[model samples]
Target: MSVSHETRDGVAIVTLQNPPVNGLGLATRRGLVEALAHALADASVEAIVVTGGARAFSGGADIRELNRPESGMEPTLPTVIAAFENSSKPVVAAIEGLALGGGLELALGMHHRVAGSRAQIGLPEVKLGLLPGAGGTQRLPRAVGLETAVNMIISGAPVAAGKLAQSRLFDRVVDTDVVQAAIEVAKEAAASGELHKVRDWTVEHPEAAVFLASARTAVAAASAHYPAPLRCLDAIEAAVNLPFDQGIETERAAFADLIQTPESKALRHAFFSERAAGKIADVGADVAVREVKQVGVVGAGTMGAGISMNFLNAGIPVTLLETSQDALDRGLATIRRNYEGSAKKGKLTAEQVEQRMGLLTPTLEYADLKHADLIVEAVFEEYSVKESVFSQLDAVARPGAILASNTSTLDVDRIAAFTGRPQDVLGLHFFSPANVMKLLEVVRGKATAKDVLATVMALSKKIGKTAVVSGVCDGFIGNRMIEQYSRQAGFLLDEGALPQQIDRAMEAFGFAMGPFRMGDLAGNDIGWAIRKRRYVEKPHMTYSKTADLLCELGRYGQKTGAGWYDYRPGDRTAHPSQLVNELIERHSTDIGLVRRAISDGEIVERLVYALVNEGAQLLQEDIASKASDIDIVYLAGYGFPVWRGGPMFYADTVGLDKVVAAMRRYGKGHEGAAWEPAPLLLQLAEAGRTFNP
Candidate 1:
């Protein structure tokens, strides 16, 4: 790592050159200090401008070096910010691409910030289970005020230079070259010869203290198991209440404290794990992915319309095939309404909506899709319909044209085998409301060609979705885990815990929505449909008897105004129904099992252990590549909070031995239920090792 200083017409340029992200590691930090010394000592250099070569300004402090004992040499970011602040000349920042985490913190230190048109700025330390360690807490509050700062820091969202300028986060936004803009700003400042000091900028609306307090409460409520967001609030509060130096000290202390936490370590592990997810061991980067300029969709229901929208929204033309003109019209109307609603909500302009709408072409014939580079079948769950659709798609679509299915639970290999071109067939399992959900489980069939896998994975990213590759299995990664997790929730209900108690415990565990609440929102009938099919295959095995009973009574969740709880028409909030409680009591009594009072800890353990146990099974079977992949699936597709890391990461934090013990206890107490500890969980418990390691 090195930082070079160059002077031209009273403007000093400081370039941070650390390969890759240019993270503020030991060498980079020391080099930065030396560069600042050169700029500040020069008599002719009136202003200093800093920028990074290549794309990223910096990702963050080098994770590989952060906690290394030998690197006591790691220059704490606060010290470097102090140097930037005490400089005689106004410090300007010229950011090209991404300025994230500590990168954004360093930018906050400068007196003036100018970025290129596409430059994005964000403090994403929260994603790593941390807050900005440098004086970002103090300075950003001074720049964008309290509320905006809190939202950005908590959400870990980055915005373009234009938005940043509108929000006044930057002193100026430049469309031309950033380095040139910085030089001009420096020269203009030198001509004026005005004393420019960031510290002297008084914070307006001192009542921002109230805003900080409210934000703290919201953070605490949002982050129960995760410590970073709440810790971030403490630093922001210090900025509001304490002196600049004291606030800096407080921010450093809080940052140091969080870096040592297990939550942070797990989250940091997850961060690197996700980047590694796309890189398969056998597949090299040279694997040729077929170009997919146009796509074709079969079926015309909600799933097909949503699938078409995803392709169209990504600026890819889609040819939608249906059996009749009526079905095509219905599908087209749904697509139109979806885009029109988005336009009305300001997510898209009317003209932009029309442009996107024009990308869709509906046809009642399969021959029209002959030119499509990729074709996806999004028909009903019935294997016959899917098989027939794939057969037709194989005949019509050109050779080497990738064939895919949006089947959630169907066997991908079976679907692949239905068509003559098995190597070209794969499963692109998009979640319901495909265009909205972030996760798309790209199921690799036994005969799925490498090129086909590569193309779908790339396409998934192009459409703004995180795709996790999985082997052909019953439910892939997310649903496979959900099957066990939801089963445990149902078991808890039979064993004595109410839906409210289960939901509460899970919420406390950092899930955005619990199983019962999720069931209510998704309509419990979906599980009923799948469960009926599953029960047919496993006739002898014992399963939860209460869920079907609830459905039998016409409680199909929020849709019918009744399910786990009674709904008030359009309202989302849940209230327990006496009828459901009576049903639970009757079921418990019919089974001759005592419905004893269950503790909150028991509710949490049973539910979480069920999922963790399944994740272990997935790991053992190689359905999930790593322990963190399961976490990513849950974090993105499910409502698993990022701060707690994910279910598997949380399990490691809770300890494997404890999970094994709970599983054993629950299995013993609830006879005939599927609450057994997974073999991998038992093995790890015996060895006393964490899943993440």
Candidate 2:
């Protein structure tokens, strides 16, 4: 029963009973139509009050229905909205909690809207790279002003109902039970004999032409990589110039076109992939998740400070440990600076900043962490350092406490060996600036307990992170795959591709920054050390010596004012360095290779396919269970553009057979061994199947 029916006074209550934010899916859409019909037929019911419980009126269409029969289910959202507009009895929406995307559109479709003061409303389909298709663009502008509606639609952020209550969007906004308020509004509308529809209202704007023209310019510049926001504005523009019916036609047409777009498909893939990464197949709901009341972080560096902020922001007390008092003070100062920066931006108040900082307890001893339910070591990326930290943690931490290492590429299994309780040891690899980054790779060691895995995954949600479970491997999931992408980038440089050229190509493909730019930002010295280690361990592996030559000349990166690109003392902008370009040329000559012009297509194909190929191999090796999990790692941590999805999803988008063909073409050119498709990749390509499906 997706919808439950009851009568209050002379009003019929058609409550959307779908739990967890009544999503407008197949069952719910059919149920809504049936409930409305029943209400309209009943002579006893004077008016109709539609609602979806207090927790959420609706979050939108169930995304689980995407690309399925359920997505275009019978009694579609359009059909349901039409029913509300044509209803003989007055229909009023009782909106509360979240009325986002399709949920907000459903509310606009009713005769009138009666919302709770706290209700958050917005059309957020643009987040999934699509515009609202169910008459929202036509109706919302007629209710709220064009500027407000356009902003809401494009940004996909919600506004409190109280703020928009003065507008025609809401008939009434009450703090007391929204359903009761809606019933009263419905009765009044019925008494007046006016089923006031949102569509009937005209959109009024004084300078619509000037505003839209300027908006088009601004959005075009800001959303060059993303097509949805600009498309969203076009649909909204129709609401201003065109009639209600015409606007709807425009909206639906735009939605249809956008839905088929690769960008939209990619965004949808990323949305689903992020959620999929949280669910570990082996860890069932029956596995007990430990309550992490107090947290301990065993370092006072940048990573340690950032990790501590996550717990502090979540209102959980944290004990931050460092060897020296000066280091502890520096870490505490860094945390305050971050919080104060937020305060300056009006994201936090002075009181809230102090409140969060007050929760931090700086310590010089491990004994202070005995009562902590979870302890993370964010020290250094060395085996000896981790052994020292874990051994001390094993001695001092409570019996059931989860001990985690924040190692980017170190072996988690060996780190677990340093501790007596191997089951408690796992890797909680947070990217740099741990608090801000959403990806938390939960590396499960051979001895890692299911409960330990489940607890960390559950805790990740509380702290606002997408936790993906990874089987123990060097570089884990994101770093491991990125290693290949970086290798291709270096090889591209060795083959005469300039730093900016490769970066521009990747940027055009929707990467935030190319490997060289990222390396410069993250410090080229870090990769130099990793490559140095890999060169010793993997003697037969091929690598371009251009980066090594640059490092040897003592050019680190932004920290040293130069690396692949030069930077001004205070600015982060990457200016091309002739010194590095000359080094790349010399290295190409030294390798006995003829330097040639490389196309942007070649750069993107080589780098992204490198990821796709390695991801397939990881799947075959059982390092990753699902393809979507690999996508999530790149999407969340590695700055893979949301519009391109992750490497695997993007490969699926390009057709695996085509991807394989392109890889073979590149293999014939350079690094043929690296370009050889993985067994799983070849199998899927030959079968004319995708990595995801």
Error of 2 at 335 (Å): 1.0
lDDT of 2 by residue, 230-281 (tens): 8888888888888888888888889889988988898888888887888888
Give one clash count per candidate, in the order shown: 0, 0
**Which model scores highest in lDDT?**
2
Q: After superposition, how far is residue 399 of candidate 2 from its true place, in Å?
A: 1.2
- Looking at model 1, residue 69 earns an lDDT score of 64
Q: Give the range of the ten consecutive residues with the poorest summed lDDT in model 2.
A: 65-74
* Cα lDDT tens digits for candidate 1, 1-693: 467888987888899888777888877888888988988888888888898954876666677766786235646676776778667778888888878877877877777778876887778888888888777777777777777777788888887767768654676787777888888877777677664555555555658777777788888897777898988888877777788888878988998899999889878877776776777767788999999999999988888999899999999999999998999999999999999999989999999899998899999999999999999888988899988898888888898999999998889999988889999998998887887988888898888888888888788888988888888788999888898888878777777888888898888877888898899888788889889988898675556788899999889988898999988977977998888888888888888878989888887777777789889998999888888888888887998867667888888888899888777777777753576678888888899998888
Q: Over the full model, what C-alpha lDDT does candidate 1 score relative to the true structure?
A: 0.83
Error of 1 at 495 (Å): 3.3
Off by over 4 Å in 2: none
